[model samples]
Target: MTDDSGADLAWETLYGETAYMCPGFDIQREQVRLPDGTETDFDYLSESASVVVLPFTADGEVVVIEEWRQAVKRVNRGLPAGGVEGEDVDLEATAVRELEEETGYTTDSVEHLTTVEPANGISDAVFHYFVARDCEPAGEQSLDFNESIRVETTTLDALREGIRDGDVRDGRTAMGVLYYDAFA
Candidate 1:
């Protein structure tokens, strides 16, 4: 099918089933008709949108967190990030809260940088990116029982080296830093 823009509408969902779901995310199984009129099965994940903050100090140091990531079975060095919980506030507020919660830093200025589809093909996870300037020590990190995060800083040079050396393995973290560089 073609719309007003003459863009060929490609896939048509025949059916979908919620295979599994938890509090934060869900998995689905689906069958769809391809543009070529062939049918196939597909799977995808759904989750609440998330936010990542590239926080920097007044002197140009990027604020980061070293934390144990159970998914990776090791500690990860990455920017502060969290899910947009509830519907009470905006993505900017979510960034601010996550920064403080995971890093204990507050910023006087925060601005939207970009939006990222972390996993475009298989996950409905949109990651909003922001840059916070002139951040300073606010208070101790307020972490959940399962969280263990430590706030740290590094110059962009060192950060690049870390990423090159595989010390920074979080894709979002590396991507956020590169976006910060372009948008800085």
Candidate 2:
């Protein structure tokens, strides 16, 4: 047996430090020695692992959220997602918690679909996508102070149409829906 999985091409990180810090993420800069015998510095966003849940109601509708995204200067339509918090036990728990907290929807079953590095070149953002089934309204949405969210329910086909029509522009949601559609 042989292990030739590009391990030899890996760069050696000589030093790494936080260039900037914020509430959700931080900018990390690192000095590394490349496999080509060259040294350089690189910077990237360091974010916590997160989960994106595509929740489905028992009646076959999908749970979605419309939230104000300050960076994009618009209310973006997306699925329930959030960073893994300190108290979250694991990725599946975080997905369930985020689905309920962001959209007031509770699910009896959750299946992990896939994990992806959404922006590997610029950041180490690991997104765990899950399919949550039999979701029903639990209570009022419990959102963060900085969040302004509105919940909606629609058929899975309609959500897929939204993805095709460019109405669902959030990358995480789009990716989750498309991935589930193609493989799940």
lDDT of 2 by residue, 13-120 (tens): 999999999988999999999989899999999999899999999998899899999998999988999998778777888898999899999987999999999999
**Model 2, CA-based lDDT:** 0.91
Which 10 successive residues of model 2 have the least lDDT summed?
Answer: 1-10
Q: Which stretches of candidate 2 lie over 4 Å from their true place?
A: 1-3
Tell me the tens digit of each residue's lDDT in model 1 across 35-69. Answer: 78899998999888889998889999999999898
Superposed Cα deviation of residue 156, candidate 1 (Å) = 1.9
Error of 2 at 114 (Å): 0.7
TM-score (C-alpha, index-matched) for candidate 2 = 0.95
How many clashing residue pairs, candidate 2? 0
**TM-score, every prediction:** 0.89, 0.95
User: How many clashes does each candidate structure show, in the order listed?
Assistant: 0, 0
Q: Score candidate 1 by TM-score against the native.
A: 0.89
